[model samples]
Target: MLRPAFLAMLLAGISPHVLAQPATETVPLLREIKNWVTGCDNLRNCHALSSPSGVDEEDYSSLTLHIFHQAGPEGYLRLRFDHRGEDLDLSTLLLDGQPLGQALTRDLHVELDDEGGDPEMHFYSVIEDAPARRWLQRLRNGQRLQLPGDDNAKVSLSGLSASLLLMDAVQGRVDNVTALARPGKAAASEVPARQPTPVLRKFPTAPALTAQEQAGLAAAAIKALTNTDTEMKPDAEAGALSADQAMMVVRTDCAAYNCEYEISSRERKPPYTETLLSIQPLPLDGAAFEGSVGYDETTGTLSYFYKLRGIGDCGAGGVWVFDGKAFQLREFKMMPRCTGSPYGDWPALWTTLPAP
Candidate 1:
């Protein structure tokens, strides 16, 4: 007779198989679903926002809705509304021109939190899961989501359902009771497990350089840059990386509008032995063609920001940390459409957790 443990294993092999989580490495993704844009991070956290393209410039009265959903059984769904104009009549918000009534306005727990200190008081509110779900149910059949007392501030509901469905798919919640778009009797345990955030080990910053040494290093890097392009000037920044290593950021082109910058690493003293550094995800096509790059001496971090327009409502940005010997990307985010969303609220295309 088989041992008890061996018998249990043999019996378990005959039982029905359960859904398993994906084993492949996860990458960040961004998708445009009609009037909405949704993105997911490496950890499977997803964000959905109203399309910035739908609002015209100078439309301050327009309200924006942002949704966030995390992965796993303990994940939560959060909804926030941002309004930058006059005090809104929350009761007047309508679905297909019918009032949403006082119930939702109260459930939203609306509050004016001008955390950014913009000139105008921006209305910020967070809706609880139950109420947010009810709102979604009501929105499913509506064509327009209209703001109270503002005819010009209406959001198209065309793509919201598709966006939520995409979010559910990304988090492996489809057919599970926790699904946002379509809830089924499938157990939540069947949903895929949340991916772990990557950790980065950052190196301590190098010793500070004297003013004279900084100027010399900056000049050497500038000479290397100017050798490639005659029009380059003294607009360059330099910082120490180690006892004998240094980094230099030079402005390559900025005749008009947005500026262009390039980064290079080299030896601290004469001969320089400079090598140009290439940034990943490349820069967006318009606005600043090559984008802007900079270094922070205190943190030993290099950063880049690319704007699609002068207003900076949309674009991409990234951060890299020096690991003593080389730079490693720590985070990256992008907002492809020029929606008037805050730069810090952009969707993450890449992310890494810091070492504890």
Candidate 2:
């Protein structure tokens, strides 16, 4: 039988089935997040708690956990632990609790960013990340990073990882530090499997407009969006739907924090065309990656894809077109880092593009 101490090792003692307060509004500091985290010795937030997530409190602190979900900064579903007599391990993110190495490594260098706060506060900004790789380079544009510190020009840099937190009103003499970490959001994004996508029952794609072929226009857009932290490429080639064949359709729309598109496009020469369906406003809170479709379309379906800020052309490759109405594991790939590739990392499952 699991003892209380055993349970405390996974979660912080909260019920995994219970939802903790999210960090949406500025949370009143029962304790500074940084301080509280670096000093968490109790299992209240460490282990034994159970929520609908089945994640124990102790699981939350096991820096080695590969499964971590955050409901934005407001809410988090993670498996981590505080540094108490143990070295903080944050090398990579925990993916389903399995540690991934160079094979899936996206970050190779943890370069420091710009200076953080005013000297009066003696605070500094540093990014706990790898050097500017292709994706990191694109994400770095106009972005700012800083260390969490107190208003008084002071910082106690001990017992902290590469995360953001508030430090004390004093400064530390440390410059750089390293720790062994395990391998590694917002709104709930549900990824659809190879099943048939949902059709509006009545809402088919809008008809194609424009008389001339627009390959040149798509080419132009591709040129313009390169490396600008905009535009995306599909991660992999989706199960192909012939040009305007049957009902294979692709379309998209978005809100802040995310730009989504419902895909159903086909293979055509010159410019590829896709139909535009439901365009939701950007940044639906609590919205993560989502994909689900249940229509009577014999064997065709649509995929839910997103365009994230700072992550241009850096995401999942394509959706898997599974057999037997059940979407199975289609292989996963990353989008090319160049321009003119399938925009965004995930590809449009529907091959039929909207008529321009």
Candidate 3:
């Protein structure tokens, strides 16, 4: 015969083997997913998350880098950098938690290669896993990571990328970092704790727009950044305009966007022309069009180019607009940035932004 208390204790000891199977499988699978650079850029705005690349930060020497887990396709990773830009399109630009749409900035380029198999298992199981393991023991908690790691990463802006991430996002902004995991989850270490990043919250104190126009612009910009489409009711253009109209005005008015517009028809101060063509997407298909608009503040004429027929690495000179709202095809011209280079912003434009 045995004491009842002793028998109960003996039975409890035998339960140890009951819960050890899943933990064995969970650890190894996460360790083999591997790491790869889905995209790499050493240029400014590499990730295109509204943070201007090539542009230095508000005179600060420290640079920020962001690494995203999945990009282009599922199971891949992408790393990019952002610095800054100016008078930005609201539909696409974002920095940290705010919007710095029109600040001149730089874009940083990055490069990467990976030897497959998760580096995560190496980091978590061997090092960081111990602390969480210690914490997990007290509560007898076996969380399954019921939640997924994800962010929307999209907004309605057309002028800039909606969101961005970097591999080096650690040093600059890591306070918002938080992570949740399960017992023996090997990938737990790579799951960075949520960090508070700096972004433009207060819109710049620029010249003001009317309430109606401002609200309309804000909404349209948000829509564009988020990629939402509107049905376009007739008065939709009256009380508030669509993203297309707001963006068109910006292109027509901006120097860079209008770079080709001034070159389309005639010669401005030379080295610039009204016949300037733009750098279109690869293959020169009309699917994603690229053109320019010109505004000569002195002349107050705003116009855009509708007919550009060439594709090459060339920069066009300035254009003289006869109209305040439309560009005349006759004024078409071109100013070559360089010879034999791809038709695009200077490769340097692919670099980081100057200090804001």
Candidate 4:
């Protein structure tokens, strides 16, 4: 188990080296540079993304750039452009006011644009060998990179070098020739191997409860929620119980937009020994509960979705799978700022391996 202070540092995206922990045991990290936010998962796959709103821009722009670097000696680097405007002529793309030239060719870049009206277009390209080295040289010292013409947007390159340097450091690529920010003659073979991902195997599903068992469990949950001594009638809408009647998950309160729920497990029969199940607490508040939660019997998974706003653009969420005894974290993701991005776009702070 991670110490409280260490976990807090990881949650805040502080580099593990700041805490003097071994590199092999480094937790995932997320750090914000001047104009970019960078993060790396346990597997050492690093991602750096520029904000839609640049350092000097007041309004959010429609174009963004994303750079990805995989770990290990043979890992690859990729660059992607997401544009929410009209079709772009690749020939007009600019890197610090100069034409991108043939460095960005259609044969090397794949366009995945939507077909609808005012569709969002994505230009994705994998960079390796000579082109990767040359582009890295240009980008590390460049000022601004943009796509020219109407609906113009620029990603500030101010903090890009520092961001890439951090990525190289995290993956042990400091002086390696493959380093994005600080390349040297050191052989790529010296780079560390990618770490294996953690895995959590879900327990077998519990047997379904009978109608009577469900009703009894529901009543008990309501009584506990209301803090009443005697058994109380269950509200049809809020009555939710696990398949085996061993867990009760239901909403207890709500405000203008957010609703709070409680999760508790108990003994199967009378004089039930019920104990509330608490998920990992959020850094914002000391609370260890979720806004909305549910249980899927077939998969033995309990999931939660908490919305920071009514529109549900930003917030924290996670999934915990039952292991026949207790719940274990499977994944957790959060997007602290709202940028009109979907939940799927959020950076994952925690992740586990797939069941074989």
Candidate 5:
């Protein structure tokens, strides 16, 4: 028999499990003509998104579509329309000249004119099951989408073929999934083989702030408290301020997590104003103002960090970078678990911040 030390060494050399750890890969954003966009996540899921040009003369009028694909060769589609001043009652979806019978109304929120005098309406629909597949086919081959409104108002849809093609290529590249089925033909079956999972890379920790940076943050925090746009209304019931009173003074102190500020009126009255801004000591959803906020000189970015309540060690926050005139929010990410797209948590996941 082998010696005890030799046996211990042999056991130490071998791993207990045969499976390797999952690895994550960063997939860059893909853009195509007419502003179509597609991307994939570490889990190999892919999505295609686009906003079609509006029929209305107003520049703000728009309609957006998003398609998502999972590994089971399954997928779904979402369509949204923003009608700020007009009432929209979309009852049907027509591809070319054929009406998709499977279409179902998902949601409708109408703001009456009498309530606020400013009417706003929104329409949303989620297409899945057979209807989603049928819509995909029609988009690949059809030339027009007809939405018959009152008095025979016709809305035109174009550029769908090119958009779907880009999405198909992206899904195929990332998930090895495809939805391009020929007319009157069934889609091919997906293989049962599993794709290799990727390991997730960690983001580097931000460095400590300098004295000058701390001062700057304190100043910004004070200004943020006094700005008219900021919500600084005092609660009379809480005895913080009288009903007619307003904030007349603001002071701030900077810490690693955030800058705490105090607001008061000229009288130095009772129930003084005390609040937290910029950052919070812990990560919690919907508590943006309570997160840790700081400036990173290396990246010229204002970063905020907060805890993602249910997700351990996975942080959620946003980053704002300074433009020529003012700071603008560029990116926000919430990673609950490390398996899916980093930017897939919300609609319009990535935005272009305007310069002040």
Candidate 6:
């Protein structure tokens, strides 16, 4: 007596529970396990990171261990826990059933402790020390970590040997440096000597410019300042003038890149005429020129100093010599600005051309 379409709609609205079956528990998919990973920084500092295996998504989000080595033969380890909405108070650490006496807690939210807010916790220990060396030995032999509230639960320390190897490689230490420490003895002193820092190479100076060559270089400087593409020669008819007889002035507009300059010259003769000899653009690959060009008439050494704007005390400069036919780049140096301290002025760490 019912319409076919209506009957079909009624059946579709029925719940399967009407014919009940036994309830089944939901099972979570297993996550890919990453035991430990190693990496290095631009300055060659090395780090090793790891997390516990078999940890669910919720539990793995808040826990990790990190080992770091700076530009030295020493290393350090850190255990991090994100306690954003949970309570965590670490008082002890254990490596392979042996307690780490030197483990200290660093709470980033110490100021917020009195305000009843959760704070992230970091437990740190230096591996170069005696206690840390013992821990490292245990990790190498049988990797395991046990925290205060873990109820004797220990996580396997996989990839620890490889991680230590990576740290040693960064420090330029040999395989012997990875030997485990003896019980009740200090092994920090057993670390191999750190490699010495390499020396910076210096550029050689060029021969002094001749009278005619000086005139050509001066003309080129004038052309560079005027942003012109004119070809200039060191011929006698190009108005050869001595350094004392001709004055050159260089100026920049402080552009980050593609900056141009104006070179004005004044001849101390007869009418004492001033002329814009050349208009040339700055080298497209170079930084902005900071101050005026320096010319040592006695040595015929012309220096061009360039600097990056907004970077404190960092600059690159070059010395050039005239070879009667053209100007030759004799020496070039680039200086890096010091950082992270009140005293920011440091000498140039490198003098070679930067890698492209």
Of candidate 2, the 10-residue stretch with the lowest lDDT total is: 167-176
Ranking by TM-score, best first?
1, 4, 5, 6, 2, 3
For 1-356, candidate 6 gives per-residue lDDT tens digits of 32333233223312212111101201000011235444443233444555343332122423345455553445443323222223444335566667645343322222234444324433333434444455466567766666656452334576567555544544443333433222223254555443443332232333434565546545555444543443432111122224333435444343443233443444534343565333222221333333335555444445665443343233445555433323345444332222111111111211223112
TM per candidate comes to: 0.83, 0.21, 0.17, 0.79, 0.39, 0.32
- Number of colliding residue pairs in each model: 1, 115, 116, 0, 14, 11
Query: Better model by lDDT, 2 or 3?
Result: 2
Q: What RMSD value applies to candidate 1?
A: 12.0
On lDDT, the leading prediction is: 1
Worst 10 residues of 1 by lDDT: 10-19
Q: Which stretches of model 6 miss by more than 4 angstroms?
A: 1-34, 52-61, 73-91, 94-118, 148-155, 178-356
Query: What is the Cα-based TM-score of model 1?
Result: 0.83
Cα lDDT tens digits, model 5, 1-356, are 32333233222312212111112222322332332334443333445544323332221223334555543344434443333333545556455666645433333223233434323433344434555555566465655444545322232334445544444443342233344321223343442222444322222233434354334433443544543343333111111122322222232333343333342221122232333222212111233232345544444455554443323222345665533223355654443222112233322223332332
Between prediction 2 and prediction 4, which has the larger lDDT?
Answer: 4
Model 3 error, position 82 (Å): 17
What lDDT would each prediction earn against the true structure? 0.68, 0.24, 0.23, 0.63, 0.37, 0.38
- Residues 1-356, model 3: lDDT tens digits: 32333233222211111121221211001000001111212211112212221222121111122233321111223323222222122223243343333221122122222445322211001123234223223212221111012122222121111121222221111121321112222343443233222221121222223465545543443333322232321111111111212211221122223221112222222221223222211110111112444333333333333222244333322222222223222222221112222222221111122113
Model 1, range 205-289, lDDT digits (tens) per residue? 6887778777887777667664455354547788888888788877766644446665777777777777544433321221222
Q: Which candidate should be chosen as best, given TM-score against the real structure?
A: 1
Regions of candidate 3 where Cα sits further than 4 Å from its true position? 1-37, 42-265, 268-274, 277-349, 354-356
lDDT of 2 by residue, 312-343 (tens): 43222233332322333222222211211224
Task: Report the lDDT of model 6 for residue 318.
Answer: 55
CA displacement after TM-score superposition, residue 199 of candidate 1 (Å): 2.5
